[model samples]
Target: MIPATETPVCEAAGVRVVRAGRALLDDVSIALHAGELLAVLGPNGAGKSTLLGALTGDLSPDAGDVRFAGRPLKDWGLGELSRRRGVLLQDTATSFPFTVREVVEMGRAPWRRTARAAEDEEAVDAAIAAADIAHLSGRRVPSLSGGERARTAFARVVAGRTGALFLDEPTAALDLGHQEDLLRLARDRARAGDAVLIILHDLNLAAAYADRVILLQNGRIVAAGGPDEAFTAETLSAVYRTPVEVIPHPVTGRGIVLPLRG
Candidate 1:
């Protein structure tokens, strides 16, 4: 875990957003520190994606500000911002017939004409291997399944090699094995000093992999802390409006959440 004193790669302070007169985020603040995996969890329409949009500068906050590496987000040029952070949104649609390798190579566009451009091939190859998409390298992107397309998009982000990564529901289309693989890869990235903020609905996955968690409801943070502190039965049951149970793992002692079924 990163010390609280360390400067965050990205931070939002007292951010607020209103759309069509309805507040989407209210007084929201969060930070992404190097070497830490922060998970954002909330029910549908809980402003999880709004927070991500604010942090990424895709959606301007009505009230507060976002800073990237100590500089206001507005100060960073598009190219520099691309090099500093990689974002993987929920949609990864492709209209063109670009091959998987071609799509991944596009991630290096921001580094063009720079010294880092020399590393493009190496980076792309490594990303392909990391995402386990080498077999689909020559396949056209539009031909791939939802999960395959997701992996291809992730490979593109991996090839970018940005200092911070923002993934919004990246595991939604993935199978059980791919979900584990992707989260493990994300955890590895955090361990290697990348600030990673991911939005997830899987309570167990967040409990297992997140260093810290923020649970949001009605555009406000309902809870924030380590897994053990934030993921109690009482907290989750109330926030999710469902009966749930939290038990300690037999070996790792991490919390395991199970929802009560009829």
Candidate 2:
């Protein structure tokens, strides 16, 4: 993990990946800047998750470099990396009978040897509250609903205090209200100077919350810019292989992406 005083930045440069015989990712590069929410969006098979995996240090690129806070990802010790950034995957299921608090406290594992145990506990409590899972504190992880479990996973990341957050499809299992809640939390995190990168299938959610959007197609970034520039009708139609329209939100005036019916 980068020191607390440092601005966490994760970047991939000229990244390439091949599985079996075919190329999965080709020369894709991006940088996650501190205090901004960068959303990665694309159609299925677009390699969105693959790019995320590489950026998070879970996957190694065949060619190119990935850096975390100015250090090569491979050079960072696991313990230190865990302390500097937290990753929330798309599927956060656990069959273990651990309680919500227990699962949340697991985030503090890396910091356990430090003298800041009390501070860790305080952060855990705050994360629980922030996730709105405080009422389910004593409940077992296996017994909670999908949305609740997702929230618990989010709380774990929040408690980690890592200057960066990488979330993959966090809103997939959430209800409408919870979906908004999660994205809003991402906005809040970025505002607090954390480098936040989220992979989202919902373009509207990305349009509403992300300060920047990266549109990927067939394992490459086709567009990278603000929502208005990244999500035009022509780009969406071509990349998604379907016709669509982009119009301003009736009230907010931000771009709203919607599909066109046959």
Candidate 3:
């Protein structure tokens, strides 16, 4: 649990979003604290991305409020908000050919007024290294593989050095090893006093890394709390409409959820 003395970096209260006569999100409230990784999990059309969008200011809630550092999101100007939060979107595609280094360097645009040349280069270098893309720095983004492009996008976000990270299906393109690496890096960032709100489809990954979980279904928050609490067999089977089993991992004692194949 987040300590009572600490302030949440971002928070939502009764946030709702509507589109095309459907409530994509409904009265969802959650808090994101520094040094913690909070996972939003649900089946497709469950509004996981909508919730992420609402929290990140990409989409405004039709009702209720989203606050950043105690103030409403509307009050936080776009320029400053962009600097305080970094978003790793579901896609980072570009038709124009840009070197990986160039793409990563673009993250510094928000801080250009205050950043020195040396500082910008250092940050970009560190981010590239952190994303394990040092070897691909000179490669054009359009020329890279899907997983490589995803890493470059992550590098761009990490280069921004935002206090809060909003990752939407960040591991969608990676192989097993890279998937583990990316999640571990997110864990590392959280340990360094960064607030991470990640949208994950894989229940096991959420169980392994998230400090807490928010389970959404049909635009409502079905559960919110620790992995063990949020991802019980009953809840999973109900929300996902599938038979599932939640068992303890052999070594870590964390919940290991698996779908029961017929």
Candidate 4:
């Protein structure tokens, strides 16, 4: 758990987003504190991505406010915001031919002007190594596998060296091994005091790695708390509209859910 003394890195208050005259998110509020890994879980059309878009400032809310470090998100300049927060979307598919190194270098664009005198080469190298893609830096992005491409995207975000990271279905295309690696990387970043918010479809993986879980249903937050408190069998069954059994992991004592057809 994150210490209470550390202030939240991002906070949303009474946030509402409407698209095409329909409310996608309604009066939602959340706080992402430093040194914490928050998992946002939900089924399709649950407004998880909409919430993230609000955080990234890509989509402005129809009502309410999103603040970073106590300041309104709109108040932050683009370059400043990019340097402080990094966002990784689900699909990074591009036909353009760019090497892994070239792709990662894009993250450095925010700091390009002022970072000329500073030695940012080491940060780039560290990010590649952290993402476990150091060996593929010279390879072309188009030639990489889906999992490899995901790792490269992760490296690009990490290279930005932001204090907060927003990952949208980061492991959706990854294999088991790559998923584990990606989760570990996010966990490590959180432990080092970066506020990390990730959208995930797999309840089991969310239960295992997240310090706290936020469950979204019908574009609203149904539950928010630690794994055991938020992921009860009753809650899961109701939220997902499926029968489920919440079991304890023998070693970790964390909650895991198993679907039981009625």
Return the top candidate by TM-score.
1
The C-alpha TM-scores of every prediction are: 0.98, 0.95, 0.96, 0.95
lDDT of each: 0.95, 0.91, 0.90, 0.89
Q: What is the lDDT of candidate 3?
A: 0.90
Badly placed stretches (over 4 Å) of model 3 are: 115-118
lDDT tens string, model 2, 59-108? 89999999998999999999999989999998899999999999999988
* TM-score, structure 1 vs. true: 0.98
RMSD of 4: 1.6
Off by over 4 Å in 2: 1-8
Once fitted onto the true fold, the runs of candidate 1 whose alpha carbons sit more than 4 angstroms away are none
Q: Model 2 Cα RMSD, Å?
A: 2.9
Task: Find the 10 residues in a row with the least total lDDT in model 2.
Answer: 1-10
The residue-by-residue lDDT of candidate 1 on 1-262, one tens digit each, is: 8898988899999999999999999999888899999999999999999999999999999999899999999999998899999999998999799999999999889999999999999999999999999999999999999999999999999899997999999999999999999999999999999999999999999999999999999999999999999998999999999999999989999999999999
Q: After aligning candidate 2 to the native by TM-score, how far in Å is the CA of 159 from where it should be?
A: 0.7
